[model samples]
Target: MIHSHVPVSDLREHIGRTVSVRGWVHTLRLQRAMQFVVVRDGTGLVQVTNRRDGGPLEALIEALTPESAVRITGRVVDAAQVRLGGLELVPETVEVLNPAATPLPIDDRTGPEQRLDWRYLDVRRRPAARLLFAVQTTLEQGMREYAYAQGATEMHTPKLMGTASESGAEVFELGYFGRSAYLAQSPQFFKQMAVAAGIEKVFEIGPVFRAEPSFTSRHATEFTGVDVELAWIDGVEDVMAFEERMLAHAIAKVADLHGEAVAEHFGVRITVPTTPFPRITMAEAQEILRSAGWDPSGTKEDLDPEGERSVSAHMREATGHEFVFITHYPVGLRPFYHMRAADDPGLTLSFDLLWNGLEVTTGAQREHRYDVLLAQAAEKGLRPEPMQDYLNAFRHGCPPHGGLGMGLARVLMVLLGLGSIREATFLFRGPNRLTP
Candidate 1:
């Protein structure tokens, strides 16, 4: 009987027991009368020793190459001489299921640019790539769990739409069966439609497309956007509270599961951000920058990359926190959907969640008045006829609702201090990258 169970790690308890193992050959070293091979089975790696006694075991060693699939019958041994993890396996028989081609062009030593060019090879490095995917899974699962518990229904919106959700400049236009079609930049309209449909609280985690030609570290053409919207919200502050809790839950869950791995691989000390993340208005942020001699010309309503960096540095020095919410965006800079303040129409009730100098989330209270929304659309040089369906929802019955669209990859990138959003994304689809 082939015992198809062997722990990937070489513990002392499994020694002297026969077992069957299947994995890819990670590395191999040969001596005069013995051979040492390291095999990886997804969970972890194990060292296997074989006696070169003019048999199939010796042939297997000679034929083995990096990434070749193989299965073996082995007796676990307490290998004191082996370098890896203090244990090894003595294989009695071996079978080479698949052989890899020679001369691998990419490996762990490949540089970042080349590794991105050959991502499949880069994934084989074992620790770095594996940790990234693991962290992603943990974060997603945690978000789903927390949102569901908070009475939020999960949503799946269409990627192709007849009209854009936000401003039209960043939209990717295409032909849809002979008619003009644009990829959805965000699920803003549809999520609000769910509110109109009486699904009071809803969230969506899906892909968003943008045609902006950007070479920045945090920008991507196609990205996963984590969105949440709710009805009966007083202001943007309520939305901010919900977001902080969601982010904290996800970070805590990841830390509970893989904190050690994260520390070892990424050197990130995971801190589930406490509720009530520090908040400052756009004007306040500018004042803080000006006091620090980093005057970010007041003409621009929003922070540029350098401005974001300076403000983030200021927050770090003053508050010892990596996250800061910049609130009260200028009405001219915000989209047509944002709600203008009752006391002051010049500033909209909006906020951008910045984590370590990068804008990861944009959220605000939306205008529920049909006439005001239509006028804003027209003022922004967009026709209101195409948005009739959305405007109609506001006309009949719409509660005070607001939401945010957050870049999942951008969050991961900043949390782990990664250089590019591409590094956090699996099979990144940028303007120039589309294939495997």
Candidate 2:
């Protein structure tokens, strides 16, 4: 019987011993008297050398193709001339499990769309792609650890809702038992419901759906959202403080774990951001952009992409920080649930966190008082009957709470200096592209 397969990365420990290596054939070099086969596994690659003797093994080696699944019984040896870690495997037998077809659909020269069409094959061939996911995993893990330490409970809210959770124009509605049901745009309402249910601190990392026809590099129809809610918050500042600390913790974890790999593969140096990230009010941001020669063609109260980039650039230059919170947005630009600022009823106690010139988070203190919520909804021209159930959460008794929804892919994109959200996501779902 063939021996159990050993990972290519573990070959160093088994030198001077017979072993079985299993992986896809990365490359094959055939000569008149010798053949060199480089096998690639998830961990690393190993080079195998075989001397030609007109044997059955020679035919199997000749028939092997790149990326073919195979198991090779071999003796591990330390060869000074070998390039791959100075180690080579001398094969005693070769077994081809599955041979890949010739002329792969994608290659190093393939464009983005074609590469995405064969995502699995493309990911297998790129080391940097693998490292991007590793950093993402560590980032999520660090965030979860910090949340748990802060007495936060993890939650999974329903993706289907009877009413459009946010804007009806951006919701995906379908018939459910003859009644229309909508895909949840955010876990905003349910997270508040959890707060009213006495689960004061809660967090959810789940898929969010948006029916936006945006073709920008940062927009996706379906993406992962990192959400958090905390009750008994004094103001929006509490929410911002929690988010900044949590993010710093998670980023530090990524920097600690995969700093070298990220630097090597993506050429990015991960830095753990300092606490109390620079904060500038929305009015201040617009003024800063205007001073920098920003065009005022768009809305005067809100910062467009160019305005956001200008503000981020200014903060980075002034404070040497990568993250800045733009706060106190006008009421017209915020949702009805966002609590209006007491000092200025025309503005909401809300903030947007911008990292590397991209807005990744929007958070605010929610108006928990039932009467104020209804009045705000009416002011926005929204009828209260369809949202009575949500209103009931606040009608009874709910603490003053606030939270933030963060775009997972956007964070990953900025962290690794990725050009687009598609590169950071595992299976990108966009306006025109859906399949793997």
Candidate 3:
């Protein structure tokens, strides 16, 4: 009977016992008298040594190559001189389950596009790739834990919509049955509907689609979105406060769990940010950017990428914090659903959260009054016929509510200091590339 394979990480517990280790060859070192094969399972790596005499074991070791999946039956032993876990596996039998092909398509020097073409191989060869997903899993878990503790219900809204969800120009249209259907751009309307139905506090982590053909480092055709909505808030500040606390809690958990691994793998230090992250109005942010030698005269209503980085840097210097929320955007720049400031009708109670010089989140207090919502939609040249159901939610009776939509990949990218969203995502989808 064949024994179940043990993970390389647990080999220390079974010292001196004959066990079967199943994994891929990490490295193969052949000398005149001995052969050393380093095997790697996802848990860890173990060195398997065999004598290079004229025997079948040596012949099998000679035939093995890097990344070849194999089942190695060996006895675990302590080796004080060895660097990897202070242990080694003495091979008694070998089984080559699957041998890798000669001449791999990717390596350390391979370009980004080709490496993405062969992403599975690239991830197996690079430790950072595995670490990246592991961090993502932990990050999501931390956020979910915080949300659940806060009495928030997790919901999964439909992705297919009867009409274009938002920004009609960027909607991906498809044929449904006999008419046209659109991919839900954001759960904005449905989340609001949940609030109207008395779900009070809710959140969703799901895929968001964008039809824009942007090829920027931060842009992607499809990505994961972390969304949250709350009802009966006193003002937009309540939303901001909730977000800051949620993020702080999540970051602290990540730091506790994967901080050291992140530092070792990506050279990034995870700092748990203080609550009530620094807040600055949009006009004030522009002023700060101008003072920092960045001319933003060409863009008044919105901040460009350079302007975001400049303001973030300024805030970091002034507040000793990496996160800053630029708030009170001009009404024209935001969507019609955002609530208008009572003191200034031209500005909306909205904000964009910047982390480490990147725009990671956009949130606002939504206009829940039915009459005001209709007028705002009309002013923006939006016909009420297409999104009538969304408008009807406010007509009956809805409490004051607000929410935010955060880009998950963008957060991960900034967290790991990766060059692009492509590097952060498991399988990136863009305009130019689609297959594996």
Candidate 4:
């Protein structure tokens, strides 16, 4: 009987045992009398060696190519010659499950644009791609752990909606049963509905669609958003603290499990940020930027890409921190949903979390008063009649709450110093990219 086992790198006490492994050929090195074929099983790579027999082994070697799926029976051997785990598999039998076509469209040495065009082939060689996904899994698990501990309920909101949550940004409009429907830009309204429904703390991890047309490396048409809203919060600080702990836990977990791989592949160490990530008001960040010879063009509300880069560099140099919270945005710049500060009333209680010169999250205290919310919506030139359902939540005893929406791909991109957000996402959908 063929004993089923994973690759040698993932094998622990099962070494030196005969096992049946199935995977695709990653690399093939042939010598005069013997052949070394490296097979990848998604978990890891295992080196398999074959004797110079002019039978199945020879035929397999002759027909082998990258991405050819195969099943083999071999005895795991402890050998120092192999690069992975100091163990190799000596294959006694071989079966070609599927043969690959020659001349791949893209390879390991392909350029970024070409690789993106053929992402499947690119992902096959990119160790960083695998590491990014592993980190994402760890981060999501960490979020769930922290939320569960904090009494937050997990909710899956509808992706299709009748109207936009925030009246500002562009949305992808589609005909849903012959009515004007849009892909949900966020779980904002639904989460607030949960608060009105009396489910206090809530969180959702899901896809958000945007029709943004910029070709910036940080922006994407569709991306995963990590969001959480807490009911009965005093202010935005409570939500900020929750986010900080969540991030710290996720970073620590990822570093512990895949730190070495991250370093080797991405050339950066994952640092679990300390509590209370440097909070600087938007005005202060702008002043800091000016001190660093970056004139933000007198825009106190938002940071242009160059301004973001300069401020991030300054923060890293001065405080040795990659994450920074820029808070108290000008009320004019924020959406109608943002709760204005009680003391100032000119600035909203909103914050953007910047990691390595890129914005990964936008969070704020939401306006919970019915009249105030409606006034803000009208002031922002939005029709309050269309938002009657949403406004009703505030009227029916909605708690004082705040939340943040974080872009998962943007976080991964900045953390790993990837050139584009697309590099960090699997099956990326953008304004230009639609299919495989």
Candidate 5:
């Protein structure tokens, strides 16, 4: 059965009809004869007015307070004076469902740490903060939409692993019976296993655990990883291009859906990046950074935070692009699984996609040959004896495969121009932060 009552966001649709709306009181104004109350459902806000000379709502209006939960039935009318939509609700009845407590724990000017302590209340007060998740939803949906259209199979790899997912370091070790188990650092090996299992293209969006103690804005103990694996790839360039177009499609969808609202709310300009995002080799990037007066004393194989920013700035200025892919990282910097270039064996066929001066993704063409994979593992000083199961996939027969792991929060942070990854995360899980 369809009900007559609707959300405040759709109140504009039932402008001339009498309807019921329910939400928390966003702001309440008291007058001698008439009172104005603005209420917010997660969708949007609507203004409700109660005439003190009312029929049955005067006392109820008098009892209302900020954040009061209420169900209000009223006639929707045009009020040019009202700022929101030039329309307001003239209340015929008001029911205070739950009177809010006197003092809210957090407010508009609250610090990020304190606001995190009371995230539920904090999110309720700021509609823009709510919109961040909305944008995130659209961004993820866009990726799925593109992936499904490309005939990719959606997958969920296990979060608990019998062995370390990435290199042995930065893994969360826990008890599994009398033995030990580690949290899956990334869906890296399993995603490749799926590719070897004859699933051509597979993608998963799930939690990834890292035991890093760094408390930087970008570092988190647990975070959502967007993983993608594909079989029959030409080289690392194929994987880089796949991610480039995927992210471009996602950013375009975000711009199409919530561009205007996000612009107004977050004061950010959304631009869908053009296809074939600027690409530069890691050596080229380092040289460009050096040319830009960036000193890289100890950082020879990989880019530091400042170097990444410098290279991104160079790309942005040189080509007027917001994204740049730094490819061909040294073999020492990348994992053992990354395929080494045939000509230059010292460098791996790997890439990191930088968005607006921050690294958001790392991808490479995985070595699919079983013998080479084992040799690479041995070269990296890793134990391949325990990884016989993973090796079996390649030993039997495996196609040339490649994949990338992207940080979901970091993507949203860069897209929305937010201060930090934590600001973009829903309930941030840092080294120290654990609760609501």
Candidate 6:
């Protein structure tokens, strides 16, 4: 309630009238006869004119500093010569509300690491960060609407687990009162359980943890996850089609709402990708790579980063699309839960959703049959003793289901053309970064 002044963004509606404006000083220009101070109030910016009239106003303007919070009583005036909105304010009084420290630690030229050290200040200085969050909000909202429309129930899956909830290798273990516990790597088991409980469809947006020591720009120890599961799927293609539709809707909404601002700030145009994102089976992808003379280091069951980029590039050249769904990966390259294709037992009904060069999502039609799931787990050298609770869900009558998890930060980074996932994350947590 302390900032009772009218918002700067609405100033155009009150032109030629006296009003009070509150915000931090963005910049100040001093002259012998007149003074100009641009105030930013998060919503917008207004230029305040403090004319020298043989009073204490000159001293007040001289004392003004950038980022200093102030309140100004001014009359809005439109000057054709002025650049910013062709409007400025002529202040009758200026009062310092709060003074910011002089010589900011970060600036426009500051590097990413140092800027992160002072994130709040960095966000205030860069309009791109503001637009990034705005786009993110719209993106999440769109997904929520689409999921609900598809008869999907939203959920808040637990973060704590009795055992490794996923990827047994890279999981965060913590000490409980007298026992040991681990963080939920993904809401995989729960989402599948929801389907087994006859929810039909479910989606969750929450944080997931990974204990890997990867230092890649794309990997984060903790990141927001967008997970979805649907029961009674005809095939893995159903899940892939649902995801493409969801992404297209979200991107279209983001473009409709903030396209102009995004373009102005990030120099990138938002394109709502068309449906049926080009799909190439894993065998075909590897063959293409082999034809191109790509030799991955070691005999890898999965596509390396370079191979992903090359396939994505090929997809773009061949189909003129940014998204490519690499499907039917070998069983060794997928999780034990993925259902192997009935025709070919060696390849699973799984997919990796690649955007521009990075894999943003991995989805599959899960093995809903109890016997099949347990057998697949055993084949992968997994002990079913620890995963009994998860297995129990399928044991008590389950529906045919499948789902996928998409990285929120990764999608945002690729959409905005940001070079790294760190740019999309508000407070990035990686192997080395645990502080603001």
Question: Which candidate comes out best when scored by lDDT?
Answer: 2
lDDT per residue as tens, model 1, 1-436: 7676665854466777888778888888888988988888767788888878897679878888888888877888876777776778888877889987877778767787777787876786557787888899999999888899999999998899897655667898899998899999888999998998899899999999888888777888999999999899988888999898899899899989988888888888887787778999999998887787875555666788888888988997888888899999998889889998899889999999999899999999999888888887887888877888878888878888999989999998977778899899888887778777
User: Distance (Å) between predicted and true CA of 208, model 4?
Assistant: 0.2
What C-alpha lDDT values do all the predictions have? 0.85, 0.92, 0.91, 0.85, 0.88, 0.90
Q: Give the alpha carbon lDDT tens digit for every residue of 5-86 in model 4.
A: 5654566556778887888888898888889998887778888888787886778776788888899888888888777778
Model 5 misplaced stretches (Cα beyond 4 Å) = 1-3, 13-16, 53-56
Colliding residue pairs in candidate 3: none
TM-score of each: 0.96, 0.98, 0.97, 0.94, 0.95, 0.96
Extract clashing residue pairs from model 1. Answer: none
Backbone N/Cα/C clashes per model = 0, 0, 0, 0, 0, 0
Per-residue lDDT of 292-411 in model 3, one digit per residue for the tens? 787755666599998889899999999999999999999989999999999999999999999989999999999999999989999999999989989989988899999999999999
Please tell me which model should have the higher TM-score, number 4 or number 6. 6
Q: Once superposed on the true structure, which residue ranges of model 2 sit more than 4 Å away at CA?
A: 1-4, 297-300
Which of the numbered candidates is closest to the native, going by highest TM-score? 2
Q: Can you write out model 6's per-residue Cα lDDT over 1-436, one digit (the tens) per residue?
A: 1323689889888889888998889998998898999999878888888778878877887899899989988889987787777789998778999888988898788899888888888888788998899899999999998998898999888899998854588898899999989999999999998898889999999999988899888999999999999999899999999999999999999999999999999999988899989999988998889889987658776998899999999889999999999999998888899999999999999999999989999999999999998999998888999999999999988999999999999999999999888899998898899988
The per-prediction CA RMSD against the true structure, in angstroms, equals 1.5, 1.2, 1.4, 2.1, 2.0, 1.9
> Which TM-score value belongs to model 3?
0.97
Checking candidate 4 for backbone clashes, the offending pairs are none
Error of 2 at 99 (Å): 1.7
Ranking by TM-score: 2, 3, 1, 6, 5, 4
Ranked by TM-score, the better of candidates 2 and 3 is: 2
Of 1 and 5, which scores higher on TM-score? 1
